[model samples]
Target: MTRDGAGLRVGDRPYRVFGCNTYYLMAWAADPNLRRHVDEVLDTAVQFGLNTVRTWAFNDGEDQWNALQPRPGEHDERVLEALDYVVWQAGRRGLRLILALVNHWDDYGGRRRYAAWSSTAKRADDFYRDAACRRCYRHHARTLVERTNSYTGRVYRDDPTILAWELGNEPRCARDPSGLTLQYWLEEMSAHLKELDPNHLVGTGLEGFWGKWREGRYNPPRWLGGQGSDFLWNHQPDTIDLMSFHVYPDHWHMDEKATMRWIREHLDAAAELGKPAVMGEFGKRGPRALRERCFRKWLDATTSAATDTEHPAAAGALFWALYHDDYPDYDRFGVYRRHESTVDLLRSYTAR
Candidate 1:
C-alpha cells in the first residue's frame, strides 16, 4: 500500500493513476435519481481508462447543500448514504478514490465553519491552532472514518476503493506565512488520520508550495505564492504517504511554461523523499486547444518519465474537472464531455 522506488504499487505491480477530479460527486449523489449522474461521470472515467478519482468527501456547516456534517459531530444520514453509494459504485466500476476531508475555501464552509462552530469569528488560519476547532475537526474525522457504509455494509476504514485520505483541499495558513503553523497542524492531523484508518494512505492536500524555511533546490519567488508551505518538508512526516500538488497557470497568471517546472519540483521532492507524488489538480483557461496542449504536456511528461528517469515518483496527473454534457453552469476550467478534442487527449493518455 506504500510507495516503492518507482512509485505506488499494488504488490509488485506499479499503479500509475490516470485520474480526474469530480468535486461535486457527493453533491450529485444526494438524490436517488441524480445518483445516475455520478455513475455517468464514473462511466466516462472508466471508458477513458482512468483508474483513479479525486473527490470531496466533506461538506461542513448548515448552509451548504448536502452538508455531510450539518453540525459538529452530527451527520445527515441521507447525504452519507449518497456518499456510501458513491464509494460502492466507484469500487464496483474499478475506480479508486482520493477523498479530501476538508476544504480551505468556503465552497463547503470548510475550516471557517469549524472555527465558527467552535464559537469564534477567526479565519481559516486560526482553525489549526484553536483548541476547540481542532477538537471538532478531530471528532469529525473520527466520526467519518469509523462510520460503516450502509450500502456496502463495510466500514470505510476497510474499503480499498479509497486510494487515500487527504488532510484538506489545498490547506494553507496565509497568516503564518512562515509555514511552521501549517506544518504543526499537518503533523497533528495527519497522525490522527493514520490512527483512525491505518489501512488507507494519507496525503496532505497541499499545492506544492516550498515555504521559506525549508526550500530545497528551487525557491520560487514569493510573488508566485510559494509561501506558507514547505511541500517537501511537509511530506517528510512518517504519517504522510503521498505528496500532492495543484497547478492552475491560468488562474495564477503564471506562464504555461511554469507548469512543467512546478511539476518537476514536486516530483523531485517526492523522489528524493522516497514517496509517490501526484499532480492531484491542474487546469487552464482560454481556447480548448491551449488547454489540450497543456494537459498533453503533463501526461507526456508523467508517462515518459516513468521509464526514462532513474527516480520515477510522479504517480500521474488529474485534470481540474470533468463535467458531463448539459450539466449546466459550465466553467472555463471544467472539461465537459462535449469538449471532444480535450476528451480525446485525456483518453489517449489513459491508453498509454
Candidate 2:
C-alpha cells in the first residue's frame, strides 16, 4: 500500500474508495451458515463498482448473539475465524476494508465495559485519560494487529486487503468540550496502532464537527453531539494518515447546499494537512428522489475535487450501510435492495 497524493495506490494502480458501511461482517462472517451472506455483500459491492468498505474490528464484551471478543484479551475463536474468512473473501474479490477498532457508543459494551473493567465510574471521556483503560485497549489492539490470519497464514500487518484502521466509530468526548482530551487520545491511540502496523493507514472515526479549543477554549454550543470534536485540529496528528468524517444532513436537518459545503470544508482541511479524506459513513431515510439528488450532488463534488491545489481531492465516499433484506433484524440500509437510483449514482462515479 502506497500513498498517492490524496488517494491510495495498490501496486502502482490508483485506488478510488467508493464504498459503503457493513459493520456486521465480522460477526456474520464468523458464522458458517451466515458466512455466505458476507460473500453476497462483497459480490454486490464489487458489482456496484465499490472498491472499499468500512466494518467493525472490535465487538467487546457482548452477549452470545454478537461478540467477537467476549472480554478483553479473550477472543472467541469462532468469531476470529469468521473474521479471517471475511478478510480472505475480500482479498479474493479484490475489495479493500477500513476496520474500526472500537465503538464510541454502547453498542458492544464499549467505553462502559472498559470503565467497569478498570473499576472506575462510567465516564465516556475517562477512556481517553484513564491509564488502565488505555492499557487494556492497547493489549486488545496489539493482539489483533499481530495475529496471523488463519485463512492466509499471514499476519494482519502484512495484509494489503486492509485499507486502514479507524480508532472508533464517531469518537467523541462530551465532557472535554475543550477538545484537549480527545486530541490527546487520538494522538496516543493512533501512534499505538501505527507502531503495531505501519503499513496500514490510521484515522479517528470522527463526525466532522469543527470547534475552537486549541487556540482558545471556544466550543460552539451547537456542536453535533454535545461533545468536543474538532475536525480540523484532530486530524493534525502525525500518526493520522487521512481525515475521516461522516455526513448525515437529513438527520441533522441540513440542506443540500449545507451538506455540499460541509464536504468542501473538510476536503479543504485535509488538503491543508496534506492528507487524504474519506466520507466514512453517510445516509438518510426518505424518498428516493431526495436521496438521489443529495447523493448526486455529494458524489459530483467528491469526484470533481481538484487534485492540483495544495489540498488534495476527496479520496472516497462510503454510504451508511449495505445490508440485504433477508438478514436478521436488518435496518433496511442496503443499497442494492433499497434504492436503485443511488446504486446507479455510485456505479457512475466509482467507475471514474
lDDT of 2 at 139: 84
Local distance difference test, each candidate: 0.82, 0.79
Estimate the lDDT of model 1: 0.82
Question: What would the per-residue lDDT of candidate 1 be over residues 1-352, giving only the tens digit for each residue?
Answer: 5567548888778888778898888988997778888989999888767899899999998899889999987889999888898999999999999999899988887888888887764666788899988888888788779989998899999988988999999998878787788889999999999999998889898888777655354444554344577787789899998888888876666675666787777776777787878888988888888888888887787787665557787887788887766476366788776677876787788767
lDDT of 2: 0.79
**Residues 1-352, candidate 2, lDDT per residue (tens digit)?**
6666677677887666788898889888876788888898889888788888899888888563668778756788888888888889999999988988888888877776777667664676698888888888888888889989999999999999999989888888888888888989999999999999999989788887876443432222356535778887888887897788887875577776677777887777777777778888888667667777777887777777644444556777889878855664344434665457777777788656
List the candidate 2 regions with Cα displacement exceeding 4 Å.
62-64, 213-221, 306-311, 328-333
Q: What are the runs in model 1 whose C-alpha is more than 4 Å off? A: 214-221, 224-227
